[model samples]
Structures are given as structure tokens and as C-alpha cells.
Target: MFGKRNGLFFDGKITLEQGDPEFIELFSRFAYDEVVNEPGAQHPDLDDATRSMAILATLIGCQGVDAYEMMLPVALETGVTPVQVKEVVYQA
Candidate 1:
């Protein structure tokens, strides 16, 4: 389920509002409802920390450095350690 501020369970630093605000909703639906919420996408074995690390790796692989920077705080808050981040980045 999406949060109240945006249609996302997690905070995404991507600034889509500068161009088309509606895309935010569209993207949220696509990412959350269509992707993240997909039955096969569900991984009960993946804990929050593991998930966060994977996301960080994926961001780095995708060249989303800005988003990666912004997401660092949230990642730590969610119990992802600095060392884990570094290792994930290195792997990416």
C-alpha cells in the first residue's frame, strides 16, 4: 500500500513533480501496485535490511547516485549498516 504523502510504501527521492505531477501517481501505481505488489515479486525470506541493501545495489547499478545518497539515511534508519552499503556498492 502507498503512503499518504505519495503512492509509495518507501520514500523515493526522484523529483518527478518538476515535470508532470500526475506521473507520480502513475509511477506509484506501476511500481507499487504493478511491480512491488506482484505475487512473484514477494519475497518473504528477504528481511528489510537485505531488501534495502539490494535496492542500494540496484540503484548503483542503474546510476541512480542521487537517489542512492538520499536513500542512505533511510537505509541506516532501517538497520542497514554503512559497511553493508559499501559492500553492496562494491558488488554493484
Candidate 2:
């Protein structure tokens, strides 16, 4: 399904040596294609930066270090400022 290397998040940089290929494939499809590609609502009230900050706060509260690591880049990419990210972590 990953026709292009750029379409895959980690792409050729990381290897999923420990997990079952079937499970990985399924999760990748669901997470990237289904969840990320779908925007069920048009929440003009919450912009991308705000959503990123909320996600950061939730990640901090949940102690989701790995997920935070992964999402931090996305947050920054979506225009979340470094100061705001730091503030969210500090507040959490």
C-alpha cells in the first residue's frame, strides 16, 4: 500500500523487525489512511495550532513519551510554536 517512500512516515529510516507484518500493515492503514485522512467535522473554532497544543497537553498528561516524540514534529509542522509546546509541557 505504501507505494511511495515519502507516503510512509518513518519510510526507509526505521525497520519494524519485532512486530508482525500483518499487524503493522493493518495499524498503519488504519492510523494513517483512516484516522488521519478523515476530517469528520469542520471545526473552524479550533485551528491547527490550537489542536496541536491540545494534543501536546494530552500527550504530556498521558505520559506518552514515544507518541509525543512522534507528534512533536507534526505539531511544529502544523505551526505550533516552540514556546507554546514548552508551555503545554510545563502546564501539564
Candidate 3:
């Protein structure tokens, strides 16, 4: 499911070679299935857009600039407005 959910943010298909299938399998399960798909009631039924915003805020707070950049498009695709993204960045 790497390419499946990754396509939500990225443009083209994601291709992983045959090295370290374990890493691939675990990352696919967590990033795609768990975080994107099956987010439980951890935040009082937060919607995808809200979750994406929160993720952006957390990334900023953690100084995860690279990860934040990677996730910015995904957050925008989830309907997080540019103003909201800016607010999160400022608040961080």
C-alpha cells in the first residue's frame, strides 16, 4: 500500500526495490494503513483535515523541517488552507 496512500500527496508512483522488505512492509503498514486509514478516537474523532493540520504543527514543533516539507502537500490536499498552514508555522 506504499504507492496507494502515498499517491494522495505525491504525483507519480512510488517504486521500492527488493532490498529490506521488512522495512517496506512495516512502513507501509504504519504510514498508510494505521496513520492515514485507521486513526482511532485519539483526538475526539478528528477529521482528516484537522489531523493533517495537527501533524503539521507537531512536525514544526519537533523541528522536522524535511518531514514537514514532505507532508505539506499532503496537508494541503487534505484541505488545510494556506492561512491555516501559516498559522501553524507561526505558532510553532
Mind sharing the TM-score for model 2?
A: 0.63
* Candidate 3 lDDT, 1-90, residue by residue in tens: 234453342445444534457888999899878865564645677887998998999998888999999999999999999999989888
TM-score of each: 0.68, 0.63, 0.62
Off by over 4 Å in 1: 1-19
Which 10-residue window in model 2 sums to the lowest lDDT? 1-10
Off by over 4 Å in 2: 1-19, 39-42
Could you tell me the TM-score of candidate 1? 0.68
What lDDT score goes with residue 46 in model 2? 79
- Cα error of candidate 1 at position 86, Å: 1.3
What would the per-residue lDDT of candidate 1 be over residues 6-90, giving only the tens digit for each residue? Answer: 5333455434564578988898889778988778676889877878888888888899989899888888988998888888977
Residue 50 error, candidate 2, Å: 1.5
- lDDT for 12 in candidate 1 is 53
- CA-lDDT, candidates in order: 0.79, 0.80, 0.80
Order by TM-score, highest first: 1, 2, 3
Candidate 2: tens digits of C-alpha lDDT, residues 2-91:
433543434544345233677788889997788766785336797888888998899888989999999999999999989998889888
Count of clashing pairs, candidate 2: 0
